[model samples]
Target: MAAGKQVMVIGADDSEESHYALEWTLDHFFKPFGGDTAPFKLIIVHAKPSVSSVVGFVGTGAGVLPIVDADLKKMAARVTEKAKEFCASKSVTDVVVEVMEGDARNVLCEAAERHQASILVVGSHGYGAIKRAFLGSVSDYCAHQAHCSVMIVKKPKTQH
Candidate 1:
């Protein structure tokens, strides 16, 4: 394995599957690559809902527009901080946390391109065949749309 920095973009959200994918990434890639020696330039991406979706909620008042924008910024900061904290706990030092405003599919692919990521990682939510067909899985979309290699990590199903 090349003992050099590799850019990896991971699509994350406030979901159990997203967290599991992070853990899987650390265990499978970072740990096996001799930890900090190879140095992974990780980019954690979280996509917030489209700002247009919340426009009506904020009303057409000009006075509080800045306030609404500030609120959005704060939410992005919180998401970035959470991702940083989680990556730090996993011994991932070189990490960039990004919170983007858009749908997950487009945002994730755009992030990978902007970051020049060598690989993109996403998690499977384990949606059923019918649901996946209709709802469209983010991981599946990333695999098809990402600029680089993609890994779709699925949580193991334990037999009861």
Candidate 2:
């Protein structure tokens, strides 16, 4: 309690795999970090593409900003809400929710740096090695970019 709690910046999005990762992380890491005696800070980080990313397509049309802003804002709020529900369901306390605007990899890394996280955790989308080569993986990018150690959790395969 006296010492500062270590931060674990988690990258989340709107996907079943991401939820699986959250559950996996809570099952494995939460006990060690957020045990009954002491709890470490758990930060849920979600990234929403910035409106500027759409500015070119919108062409600065009238009412465009308002519509885009509302949609983006609502999506971000939903993401954070989902995070909160998940944390509560897991009985996780000492949790922080951050909804950022930008590329997922960049926002997540920036959050880790800002929070001075000891470790960063993200879920693998289960892309094949060949596909991963063609389409860069977020978890891979984060592993390479994050300042601290990274954990990439993959969803368990479902039985037919």
Candidate 3:
């Protein structure tokens, strides 16, 4: 939000890979100098899928709608809270966290455009070719569709 500082959008979720990306971004871009101020204004975006999307056309009926919606809401809240807590632990307080309802690829691209971001960061799940083809990689989508530069952080397999 500060003048002269470009915005950086980070796509986060309830996954260790996503958390790794956030940590990588903070270390590489925000914590280098151990300064409170970062070169970019960070905007963390978490995509929360809608109940209808989760339910699909299975026709499980209205009985399952409320429960599914509640679960989704709770999950979104947890993701955002975890992100905020991680940032706090890193001593990075200047950030805006948002939980938008939609698919991750769309939500991340939209957040970058909405924030006029200079860069968008997302984590890679390191899925195999078949899995990626089936799941439709969100990072791959944003890399091509986003208006700004994109960074896909891959967590090392042996980092456990």
Candidate 4:
């Protein structure tokens, strides 16, 4: 693996599965290639729903829109902090945390392309075939569309 390669980790709503995937990438991929001798750049991407969707549904009528700006900022900050911690633990010197507004899959793929990422890492929700067919899966789309390699970390299943 080449040093200083760009790796992009797609983060969701801070779910346990996403956290696990982040940790796994840090442990297995970033840490191995990140240090004084082996330096790598890590970019954490968090996708928020686009405001256009909301505006499209709800017209700009004269009404007091409950702007939860503080909440959004807090959530973004939390994600950034978590990503920072992971990078720090793995000794990744160059790290960036980006909170973008768009659909998850589209944002992730776009970021991967824009960054010319060597690899894209994302968490799998483990939705069944039916669910995936109906709702689509970000990991699946990214794996197919990304210009670079893609890694998906799925949550451990419970033993029945």
Candidate 5:
């Protein structure tokens, strides 16, 4: 299949699974679509940790520390650098990086909608059914709610 005009590669965090998915999409999916030959854009969307959640739990016996805006900014810079390297290596053109605070699923969906992205690419953290059923997986939620097509990539298991 041909590649989408605008593709949002969500979740460029420090997770190995996310990195794997990002690389895979760039190498296999996007590259095959002609790399820089096509007039397409790659947008990297990262989620910032919730400060309000931390504040809400404060003085309530919750030991969680509020993630400062500076910390989030630093993390976003790293993610942007990694994304740029990935895109440059694959020769992707017109790449952009976006970092925002609040829920991951919500941010991803909103970005996709705003960009009019033809597809959304994300990685699975391999959460178990029990946990996913309770908390819900970001990939699962995006797949269900996103207006565009969604692709969920999982890390390959290593054989012993």
Candidate 6:
């Protein structure tokens, strides 16, 4: 937490697109100018879906709740580790990683407000309009709800 530096909140998940967003942010914002001492304080947030939300109806899957919960916990750990490792690899170790439980849309917006962020970065999943309508878009919600400016980093289509 560097004094006088603006805070940047980056939304991370167990997705390749999110990793690209992290890498892209480091390269463009932290790498070129900041080096070891970045101008902006970085906070990486990973939203863990609530067990009930993941279980949905939970009738037939009720018995597997424990299993699902364990899996989710493991995933969260992996996400946090990956984020930390990636930041370390880029020599940007002055980072705060948060794994909160809730919907990503709300979690990211809350993080931006909590940290008084100057910018919020998220990866675009590139879902079609129909799919986005049904699945909802975290990036879209954050763009409109976050207190600070939002950056939706879309991975190159050819990269994968």
Better of 2 and 6 by lDDT: 6
TM-score, model 3 to reference: 0.95
* Residue-wise C-alpha lDDT for candidate 5, range 8-39, written one tens digit per residue: 55567778988998888888767886776654
In model 3, where do residues sit more than 4 Å from their true spots?
A: none
Q: Which parts of model 6 have CA positions greater than 4 angstroms off?
A: 57-62
Q: Is candidate 1 or 3 superior in TM-score?
A: 3
By how many angstroms RMSD does model 5 differ from the true structure?
3.8
Report the lDDT tens digits of candidate 4 across residue range 48-129.
6654555556675535233444455577788778777766776775667888878889899998888888788899999999
Best by lDDT: 6
Positional deviation of 105 in candidate 3, in angstroms?
A: 0.6
What's the lDDT for residue 129 in model 4?
100
The clash count of every prediction, one per candidate, is: 0, 0, 0, 0, 0, 0
Cα RMSD for predicted model 2:
2.6
What is the C-alpha lDDT profile of model 2 across 1-160, one tens digit per residue? 2266788889888888888888888877776545422345789999988887877676888778778988988988888899888887777866889888899989989999999889898988899999999977889999899999999999888899
Query: Ten consecutive residues with minimal summed lDDT in candidate 4?
Result: 61-70
Runs in model 5 lying further than 4 Å from the true structure: 1-6, 55-67
Candidate 2 worst ten-residue window by lDDT: 31-40
Evaluated at residue 103, the lDDT of candidate 2 is 91
lDDT scores of the candidates, listed in order: 0.81, 0.83, 0.92, 0.75, 0.78, 0.93
Error of 3 at 133 (Å): 1.0
Please give the distance, in angstroms, between residue 28's alpha carbon in candidate 2 and its true position after superposition: 1.4
lDDT of 5: 0.78
- For model 6, residues 22-86, the per-residue Cα lDDT tens digits are 99999999998655577899999999998888888565465788988899999999999999999
